[model samples]
Target: MSLECVHMPISPKNLLVVSHRYRSFQKDPIDLVSPYFDNVYVLVRFNKFADVSKYVHIPALQPFISSSKIDYTNKPLNLEVYKTSMFNLPLDSQYKKLGKLHLSVVEKIIGENNLNFDLIHSHFIWSAGYVGAKLKEKYNVPFIVTAHGYDVYDLPFKDDEWRSKIEYVLNSADAIITVSNSNRECIKKLDVKTPVTVIPNGYRQDLFYPSDTFKCRKSLDLPIDKKIILSVGNLEELKGHKYLIEAMDYLLRIRKDTICFIIGEGKLESRLNKQIKLAGLEKNVKLVGGKPHNEIPLWMNACDVFVLPSLKESFGVVQVEAMACGKPVVATRNGGSEEIIVSKDYGLICDPARPKELAENISLSLDKSWDSKKIDSYVSQFSLSVICNRILDIYDSVLSN
Candidate 1:
């Protein structure tokens, strides 16, 4: 198909994009949208030692210039500034002025770039959206914001300051986009005036799919004899890894051959380890540090079931990935899970924060003979091409207006 034939009418002017996760470039919607723009200016914070992964290293598409460099080194100077720039920090630091320093630096970067942006696109409400609201004020540019999880669900709304700041961004932005219907409802409760659009995060179908299970397992040096149950997410309390571990322990008790592998890492790793040790699952549960995002499909395909037990999520992008790999999902009935995991068909949705329920549902999933076709059908809804087209349509509607 010709490029012109497929693309909706969109003029590439200037799009200043900001996101927290460009490090995982493949999952970034802005990366998918870059082809439609004349210039895509991205602003992202990257850990000092983390390599510039797939998304940032892609050979530039000329005439569609894009560049960004966020200093997130572990040095004391950068660390001090980062601490002050943090948004929606815990109650102890809620009154702190971290967001102020963060915004100042962000504003300076916007100014220094001399970017004559027609609009600002911020990912999430607290950090990027908050910064975008300021850019809208200073430059009189039409700004749009996208809300993803923690920005809305994790923030303490009872606090007047956090509530006021988030509401300010929501009300001030020219447009708002969320990844799921659930997120839209959550935003409306915050009294956001900006019209909210539901645009899901997408996967690179070309990169992720149901692959040779044995080959994937062999490549990872995992035992071919075990029935793998996999969970992918940062090791965090909210992610509900503890619940999955509990479920896995129960499964192992019943079927001693089952193994659970967790991918991704965070501060919660230690706590999770303790849980696994306490449960006597140290031999069966493996906490593998984060693999490159592109390599996730191999792990997904190698597993019999994919679990995302997040107590809360604006949208669980990992669930979609599991479906894409033709594996059934068992997730919690938290934020976005309801919007995506319909019911007994696509995957199981257990009560949020309940380990026993999670174990029961997981057992059911393991017993059932899942239809691979159904799995593919479920994930296809959020394919990158479909999501990119939806976002392009949104941009088209905005620019056309």
Candidate 2:
């Protein structure tokens, strides 16, 4: 599916982006779109606990906590980032109040730096979207929010109060952007009047293109003879790492020539490790903590197939990255994976959380002959250039209105 390139004329204006994690998928669009604007100001919300983590000695908690400081030495010249700390408690009732707290933190930063912007785009509806909504009221600027995963599908349906809060944020926005049709339907459940656009997450073309499989495997010190099955996601319950391990148990019964590498770190690390030991998959399935963002492309190239066993997803950007590397994907029928792996050409999809079904699909994918060039060609539509053009068109429309 080729995307039509919409080339809008660039105007001199500043853009303020409010994102919880500015370095992840949120950063992809900004990297491409920032050149068109005068300056792109990013406000990254950091947990106040990270400051305390610096003094405390907790190895288990360190993976979840990030440094409050952002090094901009290698960042884009037009991009300006502000890492601000906020008090966030992991309680269901405290969700709405966190919005006001976020607004207060943002207000302090804006006042101290005298930052100015013509528009605001926030990732995730809660807290960030709330801040955007409140700021839109204050400055009368156009505000757009991207509802990704939990913020769209889970939070709004939590309770009556959460439903009302989410509705307020959606209706308050000039426009809403979601990652998938499934998420768009979730927004429709609220029945907000605001226009919602679906812009699928994209991968960096320069970083994720095809490479030499032999060289990649050699560099990563992975076995060249084994059929590699790689899955990269945080080791959380919703990510379905446990199901993948279970599938491996079934997979090895038929074929022992495969190795599964799960790359990530989370609170569930110890529990998953214990599961691997009990299942006797310590040799077949290896939990290779987490790799750097840039190093992930090498892993993708080294693997024979990429698996995304997520139980729920808004859009699996990792699947697109793997496809860009000309590698086939075997993902679950999670909302986003089905849309990405639309046909049998790119990859196969199995029922979520089913170990036997997942194992069958993995074995089939490993034995099948896949055309790498076709898979690579199919993923071009979700490249950074195409996705950013669509987003910029939205920006132009909102500003012109």
Candidate 3:
């Protein structure tokens, strides 16, 4: 039998996209969605350099696929797609001025190229969504906004002023997309009724998956004999790393050989370091700081278990990434983890801030005999291609109406 490929109805049109992570193109959804559009213009926030890595290593960099000649030597790597261009905000600027900046940019693009975009898509509900709503009103184009992690669980509920702004943005959009079921509920709480769809952020399998265990351990200079337990997140209060570190007391109480590595850097670094020092876990638990995004899979492969102890998570995309790496996870009962860790075979779940429960689950996960292949198979639906197709379906549905 011959196989034929069927795709969603494709219309070649210009797409004006807004995102906060355009500089880090590897995880940007626009990097995946841009290929399907004739042109995609990305407006990104300009900030201090967080990483020293060269732009050439960006896995999503597609210079040849772009329509503009952008100088990559610049701090912010800009690009074009049939007509896409990424603009970084001027220093000493704020997102509150995004509407003004977007108006100026759109005026120039429409006048110079005589272009009219079919729709606008924004990532995150703050600056990007705010600008998308403005463009929708100014140009009368359909708009879509996706809320990820903190944007869903923190911003809207943080203050009444923020709630009002976010509510208006969601109410104004033609369609709303959230990364987790937990976020959909948060949107509903705003009392705005625009259709909300759950589309999780997908992980690239090429970047995150099971690899040669020995080489992975050797590359990271991690010992081969220890039972490694890993947690990858910023050392923030919301991440609940303090509790994970507390749980380690119980872990070490039983198994002296077990080690924990907490990755990512944040303001809470000093506090977490103090916690480790006070607990006398300096050797048992190490703060590896932030590693390159591509190196995360090596840690997952080397570690026996991956744990995310966030008190409240929107989607916990990293947990799915852990699952794809063929390692079992011990995550909290955050909305996202509850859906991902549906069965005990994948791993175990406990309350977010409970050290006793977390330690128990971690112990149980360590003792469990997990089938790596089965663990990897469970996350097949969250692959980048599959998630993008579902997003495209949403795009088609919105445009057809």
Candidate 4:
């Protein structure tokens, strides 16, 4: 499987990117680099919401994604995929083993299509980075791994066995990229010697910018009389939605006009719904199913404030998106929030999972007068175009060696 093509790229060359998610509600790391590579091959681990049986039988790379539905304006990407359920019995010990299948699929595809890529870039450390490490070892090609949050902060500390796997992948990568400064600190603690770069996730200013709040509320049919407190993320335990729901009582006590909306879908919908009833927040809190990605900006524009009370967040892009729309944010002291709310000027950061603290922070944010133009300007430096070029520069640096 040794790919012997060693001619340096005087021009744009092929790039093989391995990741678990893509082109969804949020901006993807691949979205920044795809346009720079001549022909990009994306291998997605089909672990998104649905049952494993949904896309198991389909031929791999059968145009699973429609062209017209692309979230951003980027060059075409050759979308390829594989299922997590195909080998899904022992979910714990088998995920890393499943990564080998990605290599097998890529090798087979290359043999049939006569294709060769200059480098391999992977997203997370566990599955995609492990797969990329194997490819780099077998083919002698460059390998780069970008740690988002969970992989670097949580997974490595799971157990000795997990630590070994993470170390193997880290040792294999030529350069490591993280989205936040705190994420880089986590990497440093791991004693990793690989060249690491901290590249914060950028906001799409085109899709998310300050608009007339009243107009935005009218378009979304949101009540203008009440102050809208918004939290957007998948309704999972990690997101700390229950805590937010609990805070509704305190929030309502202070500002009875405030109503909170939780947007995004997950398995915890029914549980959250039940919690809403038990807490007697039925009238105040709402669990609206997954909002369309395009409509997220409208929610930001319409709401008085945005909140992300996650117990653990790697890099919360929605917080920045809300800021881009000139909305004040109330975030917990999670990994990325420490940097996102670095100054009181951007937003407020309080203790995580504490309903009272969260309630107080939300109240403070609601009362504060924010300058939308300042928040917009603060987030503009992390625009998608700037992030894309930063990645391309990294690619150039890695390839020259």
The models' CA-based lDDT, in order, is: 0.72, 0.88, 0.74, 0.76
Model 4 steric clash total = 0
Model 1 misplaced stretches (Cα beyond 4 Å): 1-5, 25-27, 46-96
Best by lDDT: 2
Residue 339 in model 4: lDDT: 81
Off by over 4 Å in 2: 1-6, 51-64, 67-73
- The window of 10 residues in a row where model 4 has the poorest summed lDDT is 59-68
lDDT of 2 by residue, 144-213 (tens): 9999999989988988888888899999999999999999999989969999999999888878999999
Candidate 3 wrongly placed segments (more than 4 Å): 1-6, 23-28, 47-116
In candidate 1, clashing pairs total: 3
Clashes of each: 3, 0, 1, 0
The C-alpha RMSD in Å for every predicted model, in order, reads 7.5, 2.5, 6.3, 6.1
**Candidate 2 vs 4: which has more TM-score:** 2
Better of 1 and 3 by lDDT: 3
Clashing pairs in 1: 12-38, 84-98, 85-98
Ranking by TM-score: 2, 4, 1, 3
Q: Give model 2's TM-score versus the native structure.
A: 0.95
- Winner of 2 and 3 under lDDT: 2
Score candidate 1 by TM-score against the native.
0.85
Report the lDDT tens digits of candidate 3 across residue range 226-334: 8899998766778899999999987888878799999876667778889999999999889887666667889999999999999887778788888999999999987
